[model samples]
Target: MKNVLHYKGYSAKPEYSAEDQVFYGKILGIDDLVDFYTENAKELEQEFHAAVDDYLAFCQEVGKQPQKEFSGTFNVRISPELHRKAFRKAQEDGIALNKVVENALTEYLSPAWHENRTVILPEEMAKMYSAEEQTVDTAPDDASHLALWKRNWTVVNGRTEMKKRC
Candidate 1:
C-alpha cells in the first residue's frame, strides 16, 4: 500500500504513532515544517488535504509564497575531503560538480520516485541496457545493479573499495 498522500505536488511521509493511535506525517523536502495527523484512514485523507489547503491559505493571508517541496536546486555543505573528491570526479566525468551531485542524489533517492512510477537511471546502466532490457521483467535488481557501480575500485587502508561519492 502507498504510505503518502500527495497534494499540489507535495508529499507527506506516513508514520504511525502507536501511543496516540493515529497516523501522522511530515511534509518532506520543504523549507517550512508542516505536521498532520488523524486517527482513521477516512479522516486521515481529509486531514491531509486540509493540512495542505490550510498551509496555502496561511501563506496567502501572511503575504508569503508557499514553497514547493522540491525546487530542483538546494545547497549542501560537505567536508573538505569530499570537496576534493567531488572535484576530481567532476574532472574525470567531464561534467560539472553540480551535475555530479544532482545525478548522485537522483540515484540515491530512486525509491522516492514511486508516486509516478518514475525512475532515475545511473549513467552507466542507462547506456548499458538495450531498449528491450527496459522492461520490468528484464530490469536489474538492487544488489546486482549496485555491483555495476562498484566496478571501478580503489585501495583504502589496503582493502579494495568503491568510491560512492558524486
Candidate 2:
C-alpha cells in the first residue's frame, strides 16, 4: 500500500521495500532531497516530521534559502498554430494573453473554481442581512447562458434593453 504523511505543510510519500523490511519515504516537490524510514506508521509519521525539521535546520545552518514547490511561472510547449490562436483570441477580447492562459489553466485544473465554497454566510456579517433586504435577479442555473454574458444588449428590470458595449 502507498502511504503518505503530511507535516508542517510538506507531503511525504512512503514505499515499502520487502527486502529491507522497512517503509521509506521522501518529500515530493521541493528540490531538496529528504528521506525517512520506519517499519510502523506511527514511527513513520514522527520520522517524516523529523526529516522536514532536519531539512529546514540544515538549510538554516548552511544559509541556503528553502526551495519552494512552484515559482508561478513555467514554460509550456504548444503548437505554433494554437499559440497564434490564443494570442488572437486574447487580442479580440482586449485582454493580455497571460491572463487568458492563466484563467484557462486555473479553470482546467480546478473544476470547482466558479462554485461557491461556503454554504452559509459568516456570523460576523449577520447585521448586514438584518437590514431591509433587497433581492436581485439571480443568474441562470447553467451559467454558460448568454444572460450572464455581457453583450450589446442585456435584460434589465424584466425588459430587454440595449446596453453600451463594453
Candidate 3:
C-alpha cells in the first residue's frame, strides 16, 4: 500500500497510489511518470496532447501573453475577513490568492487610462491583415473595425494640423 500525502488545510489525505499518481500526472501532462508506470500510457499521451491543443486554442482566443518571471514582492497586512474573501475568490478564479491580491492592488494603484491598446485578431482576420493584397486604403464595413481606424486616423490628422500651425 502506498502512503497518502496530506495537502495543507485539507482534512482528507490524498492517496499516493501508483494508479492515482498516473491519473493526476496524466492530467498535469507529466509524460515521464505516465509512461514509466501507467498501463494506459497511450491513452494518457492522447489526453495530454488534446489538453495541450485545447489550452493553445484557449490562449489564442483569450489573447493570453507568455507569463513573465517575477523576482520581488512586498508584504502587506489585511483583515482576516478580506483575506478569506480573497482566498475564496482566488479558488473560484483558479489563481493563487496572493496573485489575486497583487492584481487587485495593482489595479487600484494604477491609472485607468493605458498608453496603448492591444488588439487581438481572430485567426482568419489575422491572416487577412498579414496578406500583401490587403491595403490601408481599403475600408472595412464592420462598425467596431471602422471606429478603431477612424479614431487613429483622426489622431494622426490632428497631429499633422497642429504641426502645420506651429
Candidate 4:
C-alpha cells in the first residue's frame, strides 16, 4: 500500500491521527505548509485533490508561483578524504566539482549500473529463443513485469551468485 498521495504534480505523505480519527497530510517539497484532512478513507484522495486545487487557485489569485517538487539544487555532504579525491579528479578532468558530481550521479542512476542485473529485451530474446517461447507481453521497462522473473543475485565470498527464489 502507498503511504503517499499524488495530485496535480504535487505529493503528500499522510498519516493517520488515531486520537482525532482523521487522515491528514501536508504538502511535500514546497516552501509553503499546505495541509489537508478527511475523516473518511474514501474521501482522502478527494481531499488531497481539493487541497492541491485550492493551493493553486490561491497562488494564482495572489500572483505567486506555486513551488515545484524539486528545484534541482541540493547540498550533499561527503567525507574530507572523499571530497579531496573528488576535487582532484574534477581538476584533472578540467571540470567543476558540480559537474563531476552530476556525472557520478548520472552513472550511478543508469539502469545498466547494476553489473549483475540480467534484463533481456524482446528483440534480444528473439535472437536466442523461438517465437513460440516468447510469452512476456509486458514492456521490459515495466518493473512489475521484471519482478515476476524471480531471479535474485547476491555476492557470495567476493563472487556474484544467481539464485532462483521460491
Candidate 5:
C-alpha cells in the first residue's frame, strides 16, 4: 500500500507495499528517509509551522504581497586557495561563502577610495605651452609655475599688515 501526504499544496507519495517497498525502501534509500521522518517528524513539522507563521506575519506587516517565488542567481570565481580560505571563514561564521565574498567586494568597491580636489585646471594649458613656445629659456618650466603662483598668492593674502606697509 502507498500513502500520500500533502503540504503547502504539494503532494508526496510514499510507498509502503512489499514490492514497491523493496524498490523504494531498500534500493533508493527511502528507509533512511523513513527513519528521519520518524525521529524528527514533530520538530520538522514545528519548523514548517514557524516558517509559515513568520511569512504570514511579514505579509501582514507589509500590507501588500505577491505570491512567494524564488528569484535571482549570483556567481563568482576565485583562486582555489582563496576559495578554500573563504569557505573556511564562512563555515566559522555560519554564513554562505557567497555572502562573505559579497561583503568583501562591496567594501573594496566603495567610494572610500575617492577624494575631493581643491583645484582643477582647464585643458588649454597643454595646447598653449606646446614645445614651440620656448621664448624665455626658463619662464618657470612647465605648469609648476601655476602651483608656485597659487602658493605665493596664499602667502601674500595672509600678510594683511605687510600689504599696508607696502
Candidate 6:
C-alpha cells in the first residue's frame, strides 16, 4: 500500500494518529510548512489534494515559486566498508560514486529488471533438484550463463540473498 498521496505534481505523506483519531500530513518537498488533517479515512486523500492546491494557490498569491517534488540530489548514509567498496568500484569503472549509486537505484526501480529476472533461492533449488541429481544435461556449460547466475545470486554464510528489485 502507498502511504503517500500525489496530486497535481505535488506529494504528501499522510499518517494516521491514533491519539487524535485523525489522519494528518504535510506537503513534501516544499520550502514552507503546509499541513492538513482529516478525521475520516475516506476524506484523507481529498484533504491532501486540497492542501496541495491551497499551497500552490498561496504560493501564487505571494508570488513565490513552489518547490519541486524531487531535486535529483539527496544524502545517504552507508557503512565505511560499503562506502570504500563503492568508491573502488566507481574508480575501476571510470565513473563517479554518484553515478554508481544512481545506476543501482535505477536498476532497482526498473520494472523490466524484475520482470526479466528469475531468482532461485538455495533452499528452493535444493528442493527442486538434489546435488546428486544434477547432471551435465541439467546444467549448461555456457560461461555467459554461469556469469549471469553469479551476478544475480550470491550465497553468504550458507544463506542465500536476493536483492529487491521492483
Q: Model 3 over residues 1-166: C-alpha lDDT tens digits?
A: 3222222211111222574655323223222222122346455434445544555556579897323334567676778987888888889989997788778779757764223333344555455444333323323355564444332211121121111100
- By summed lDDT, the worst window of 10 consecutive residues in model 5 runs over 157-166
Please give the ranking of all candidate structures by lDDT, highest first, separated by commas. 4, 6, 2, 1, 3, 5
Q: What tens-digit string does per-residue lDDT give for candidate 2 at 1-166?
A: 3266787778988888999999899987888778999988568888888999999899899998766657688888878998999999999999998898899888858957444332344455443444344332444444665465333433333333333322
Off by over 4 Å in 1: 68-86, 106-166
Model 4 per-residue lDDT tens digits across residues 1-166: 5588888789998889999999999888788999999999888888989999999999999999898656679998878998999999889989999998889899879975655554434554345544333322332344664555444544333333443332
**What overall lDDT goes with each candidate model?**
0.68, 0.70, 0.43, 0.74, 0.41, 0.73
TM-score of 5: 0.25
Stretches off by above 4 angstroms in model 5 are 1-72, 114-166
Q: Model 4, residue 151: what's the lDDT? A: 42
lDDT of 3 at 137: 32
> Can you tell me which runs of candidate 2 are displaced by over 4 Å?
1-4, 18-21, 69-71, 79-85, 105-166
User: How many clashing residue pairs appear in each of the predictions shown?
Assistant: 0, 0, 0, 0, 0, 0
Candidate 1 lDDT over residue span 1-166, tens digit each: 5577888877887788899999988777567888889888678877878888888899999998788555668788878998999999899989999999888889768874323222455556455454532222222245454443223333332333333312
Candidate achieving the largest lDDT: 4
Candidate with more favorable, higher TM-score: 1 or 5: 1
* Candidate number with the higher TM-score (1 or 2): 1
TM-scores for all candidates: the values are 0.53, 0.51, 0.24, 0.59, 0.25, 0.66
lDDT of 4 at 89: 86
State the displacement of the C-alpha of residue 54, model 2, in Å, after optimal TM-score superposition.
0.9
Order by TM-score, highest first: 6, 4, 1, 2, 5, 3
Q: C-alpha displacement of 47 in model 3, angstroms?
A: 66
